[model samples]
Target: MKIGVALPQMAPGYGPGTTVDWARRIDAGPFSSVSVGERVTFSNPEMVATLGACAAVTERVQVLANLFVLPQHPVAMVAQQIGTLDQLSNGRLEVAVGVGGREHDYRSLGAEFKGRHQQLDDKVAELKALLAGEPPFEGADPVGPACVQPGGPIILAGALGPKAMRRAARWADGISGFSVRGDAEEIVKVGELADQCWAEAGRTTTPRKVNGCFTALGVPDASEALHSFVARYLGFLGPKLAEMIAASARASTPEVLAEILDGAEQAGCDEFILVPAVTDLKFVDVAAEVVAARS
Candidate 1:
């Protein structure tokens, strides 16, 4: 499986300096992609802007938007941004769009959550058309800054539920899934359902299989560091829920991380995005070492 790393945008106090180092290191190391995620009302950097910066700096690694909450943005605007990013990265950009579950984020963005799933299905179709160089209206001009990737960059569904998977099978080229508990069984279950869904959708080829997890390593007390960092990042979920999530993050040691890698691979992950909880550059080196050893 191809391995990737995430910019520590969610880590408290991590900013442009750390992002640059992480982006360059991920591109130069034993990694196939560099990823970033979205959170509108949180401390994390905006997804498109951080990815735009990443695309500008890196030359080799695929730049992945681990997800964008689709219904929150205008479809035409989303198409334009993806087109620009695809061209900016020389066709290295891939995106995952989902109906985000965070209702508060929707309220902050002036978007509605009800009917969002249907809205996403509609928007994905519109995004595909716009990226294919089709004009929004019958007489309007097609959005330009043409994507380097023919038919634009590959799109993945940032989904966890079967209903979401069914909707995505209709348009997405792949799936972008996260393992909240970082368990291999989760990967296997998602993979099985994806295959079934795609088959039910009458797809001819295998949909791309990708998974992501959090890690807290390259520190003196890695486990504690991971829990603290996770709790901080997830503070939006309220203290009890955040603490519960942080406690479940187990990729603190090389052995533990290696186990996840092995399990993901065995479970058929084509790409595994490793999101680092620590901001130290050592985190990249250490994670790379783990991936290499597993390879």
Candidate 2:
């Protein structure tokens, strides 16, 4: 399976130079892709800027936005930005789009939180049009360069539910999912659901499958480290907290991580993105070890 690393966008004490350095390090490693997350709040770096930096410095590694909030931004602008980035990167851009869930983020962005699913569907349709080199709107000329690749960058829909899965199969080139607590079963379930949705859509071509797992590496004890990590990261999701906490308690070792990766690969995941739970940059070294051992 291909390996990817989450850009150190949220790493503690991170700055532009440190972020660039980490990108370079990961690019020099065995990773096939480097990804960044979108969060207007918290300490996370801006997704596009971080990705632009990585693209500028790396030659071979694919640059991805693990997910961008589609409903909060104008579809035309997003398409243009992604097209430009894809051109700049020589066609190595992959995007995962989603209807963001955080109410506070929507409020902050002056976006209506209601009917987000419908908005996402519309935005994706428009984006596809723009990426296809269609005019931005009636009576308006196409705004930017056609995407670098034919039919534009690989579009991966970030999905969780049955409805989202169906939409992904219909509109996206692939599906991207986060494995809560690094659970192999959850990863497999996501792949199965996506595959089922694709089959239901009567799609003959197999869509790409990407799975991400967040884990704290280099801690003194894996279980304690994962417990603390989940309490902070997963607990913030409220209702999902108990389930994530339970999963963490059940599996929290390098051996478990290996098993998760193996199972994810067996379950038809095309790519795996790993996020180091700690903010320390040293966690990258630990991540490197895990990637090497698994490889």
Candidate 3:
């Protein structure tokens, strides 16, 4: 299985230069992809713009929007932005869409929170239609410049349940999943269910299985830092749950992370994206050293 690194965009006080530097470092490192996640009501760097900068600086690694809350934005506009991002990355962009669980984020953006799943299903279709160069409306001109990829970039869904799995089977090229502690069994179960959904839908091909986990590395008191960051990032989920998530983050030391990597590979993860709990770029170097030794 290939290994990827999530940019430190979500780290507190992280900025544009740091985002670009992280991308550059990932390009120079042994990672296969550089990814960023979305959150409108947070202090983190904006996902789309930061990804654009990453695309501008890196030539080889894949640029993934880990989870774009599709229900929070206009469909055609997002299609245009994603198409432009794919063009900027020379067809290296991979998108993952979902209806995020945060009602606060939707409220902050003035987007409706209810019926988001249905809205996401509609928006996904609309995004594909727009990317395909179909007119945005009955009598409107098509959006441009067309994607560098013939059919646009591959689309993945952050789907974890049966209903979401069924929807993904219909349109998504894959599913991007997560386990806070790098639990191989949990990830494998999710992958099997996604495959089952595809088979039930009569699809001959199986969905790509991508997994993610949180960690803290190369910093003093790494575990503490990891827990603190997780607590803050998921504070909206309530203190008890946030603390629980913080407590469950995988250890980022080489020995522990190597075990996690082996477990993910054995569990059928085609790509494993490691999300750092701390903002420091040293985490990348530490992760690289571990991954290189394993490779």
Please, what is the whole-model Cα lDDT of each candidate in the order they appear?
Answer: 0.89, 0.79, 0.89
Error of 1 at 219 (Å): 1.3
What tens digits encode model 3's per-residue C-alpha lDDT throughout 1-295? 9999998766775854688788999999999999999997888878898899999999999999898899999888898888889999999999999999999899999999999989999999999988989989899998887999986788899999999899889989999999888988988999999999999988898899999888889899887887888889889999999998788886657788898899999999999999987778888889999889987
lDDT of 2 by residue, 110-227 (tens): 9898999889889899998888888987899986877778878888999978899998888888898887655677877888888899999999988899987776666667566556
**Where does model 1 exceed 4 Å of error?**
none
Candidate 3's TM-score: 0.98
- Writing each residue's lDDT as its tens digit, candidate 1 over 98-202 gives 988788899998999899999999999998999999999999999987899998888999877899899889888889998855799999999998988999999
Backbone clash pairs for candidate 2 read: none
TM-score, each model?
0.97, 0.91, 0.98
lDDT of 3 at 40: 79
What is the Cα root-mean-square deviation between model 1 and the actual structure?
1.2
Q: What's the CA error at residue 223 for candidate 2, in Å? A: 5.0
Ten consecutive residues with minimal summed lDDT in candidate 3?
A: 8-17
